[model samples]
Target: MSRVRVHNFAVSIDGFATGEGQSLDAPFGHAGTRLHEWFFGTRTFQQQVLGKPDGSTGADDAIARTWNDGIGAEIMGRNKFGPQRGPWEDHDWNGWWGPNPPFHTPAFILTHHPRPSVEMEGGTTFHFIDATPQEALRQAREAAGDLDVRIGGGPTTVRAFLAEDLVDHLHIVVVPIVLGRGERLWDGLEGLDQRFQVESVTTPSGVTHMTYTRP
Candidate 1:
């Protein structure tokens, strides 16, 4: 059976996944690149994001490597794709990942206003849909076939799927920081830890890698 997973998502100590004022200028809002400092030095990110062959390897790299392993499809919120809002003011937004995206699978973008699918250089084809988290996951699962479906998110999207109890495995990296005001991940998720077997490990970089696996 294919599982729904969340990998390598980072959140601040204050529980904010993303800060206030998300726009083209600041994709991560005021939080900036602080949340992703750990991933930036990983071999997986170096190869995928920077198109480099060399990077740090170890516990962090091990976690990063899981990103593309068994994931056949991905579902993300509109904000994850870009900062454009309200019916996609311009149709030219090809996501923050440039021409060739890292996701080499059918990526479902959840938005209120749907648009035609956009095929990038790589195998990543963005499919925009206005549907419930369940509906979107259904399409992603169909595309994934025997492989797992990854929930690529911006907090809100991940929380939606979590609320629906649709996620099987969740890997979150808690970065030590305090984003006073922003979108929080643990909100409205009271006693969510009971649903999964949780394990936490502190990496050399001080980022705590927490994995939640549903039994």
Candidate 2:
């Protein structure tokens, strides 16, 4: 059976996935890109995100490379799509990832205000929907077909899916930083770890990688 998954999701030591006051100017907010420094250093990130050739190799790169494995569709919060709140002012704002997004599949955006689907280059189609988590999963599952659906999150989205117990595979990278105030991944999620078999390992980059998968 196909699965709903979260991959390479970063969080701070204080359990913050992103800092407060997220904006178009500051996507990661006060925490900045400090949360993703380990990712940027990986060869997989250099190739996939930066479209570059040279980067470090090791456990981090290996984990980064798996972000796209067997994933046919992506579901993300409106916050992950952009920093905009309320109704969107700019209809032309495709996303933070330029024209050719990495997903290369149907990427579902969960929002209260829905919009017409935007088709982008490299086989990525942005479909906006206002539905409950279960409803959204149904759409994503159909779009995914034989492959798995990835929950590409900004904390809130992941929390919602996790709350509904829809996620089957979760990969969280814990950065060794302390963001005193930010959106937390563990809020209202007590005993969430019990749902999956978790395996943790500290990488050479001073970050711990945790993978939670159901048996």
Candidate 3:
């Protein structure tokens, strides 16, 4: 069976995946961009994010390399896909990833509203599913074939999956920073007793790399 994993997902010292007031200008919210400095400076990130190849190999490279774990398909929430709340007004916006998004594999987006699959540059196909997370996961797994189904999040989506105990492995990059108040990764998820034992931990640069497997 294929594993459902979250790779290189960054979180603040204060337990915020994204700061408050997320907008087009600030997707991670105010001061949230600083949390990803470790990734932004890495060679892997420079190539993917800035479309440039000017970064050194070191701790950053090692951590950034883990972001792409041969994922065959991606699943994310509508909010993470975009800020267009309620229902999608139209197909005018595909996502915040621009014309050439990172996830080249098929991506399944959980949404209440329906929309046709968005075919973008770099072989990224966004399929909007109106069903629950389990349904979306099933589709993503089928689309993934032999590779793993990656859960890309905006906190809530991950929480839903975590609550349901659907995820198998999780990788988190804890950055040394604190956003006093923002979208927390663990908010409203106190009752779920699904405990994940630590698989391994790597300290690359200032970021703490940790991996957990549901056992």
Candidate 4:
């Protein structure tokens, strides 16, 4: 079976994955790009996300490069897809990632309101469905075939999968900042460390990269 993995997931020292006031303007809410500032400096992010040639080829880039490794499909919460809540008022808003998304595989969006799948340019077709974490993983795993399925997250989506013990490998980047308010990643998950063999390494960027792999 293909493994369920999360990569380059950033959280503050206080465990908040994203800040409050999420809207069309603020994708990470008030958190803005603070959580992912460590990533932006990497060559992997510069090339893959920003389509740039120059970036730091340091320790951060080494781990960030693994984000797309063997990932055949992705499962993200509706919030990660866009800020629109309730029924999607406008289908014209494809996603934050322009016409061509970075995910070169099928990306499933978990939402209460299911809509027809939106096919984008870079081989990413977004499928919206209302399902539990298990059900959504089943669909994503099926689409993934022999390759692994990635749990692309907002805090809620990652927390749900962690709560259900669905994740096989989790890579969390603990940024040094403290956001007192916002969506937290470790709210209900207590003793989560017991389930996985954990390892941590602090990079030159001042972020601690923690990997939790199931034993």
Model 4 residue 204 CA deviation (Å) reads 1.0
Per-residue alpha-carbon lDDT of candidate 1 for residues 1-215, written as tens digits (9 for 90 to 100): 89999999999999999999998999999999999999999999999888999999999999878978889999999999998888777789889999999998999999999999999988999999999998998999999999999999989999999988999999999999999988999888898999999999999999999999986
How do these models rank on lDDT, best leading? 4, 1, 2, 3
Q: Compared with the true structure, what per-residue lDDT tens digits does model 4 show for residues 1-215?
A: 99999999999999999999999899998899999999998899889988889999988999989989999999999999998889878678888998889998999999998988989998999999999999999999999999999999999999999999999999999999989899999999999999999999999889999999988
List the candidate 3 regions with Cα displacement exceeding 4 Å.
188-194, 199-204
User: Candidate 3 residues 70-155, lDDT tens each?
Assistant: 78999998878987788676789888878999888998888889788989999899999887778988899999999999899978
lDDT of each: 0.93, 0.93, 0.82, 0.94
Clashing pairs in 3: none
Q: How many residue pairs clash in each candidate?
A: 0, 0, 0, 0
The lDDT of model 4 is 0.94
Which pairs of residues have clashing backbones in candidate 2? none
After the best TM-score superposition of candidate 1, give how far the Cα of residue 112 lies from its true spot, in angstroms.
Answer: 0.8
**TM-score of each prediction:** 0.98, 0.98, 0.91, 0.98
- Model 4 TM-score is 0.98
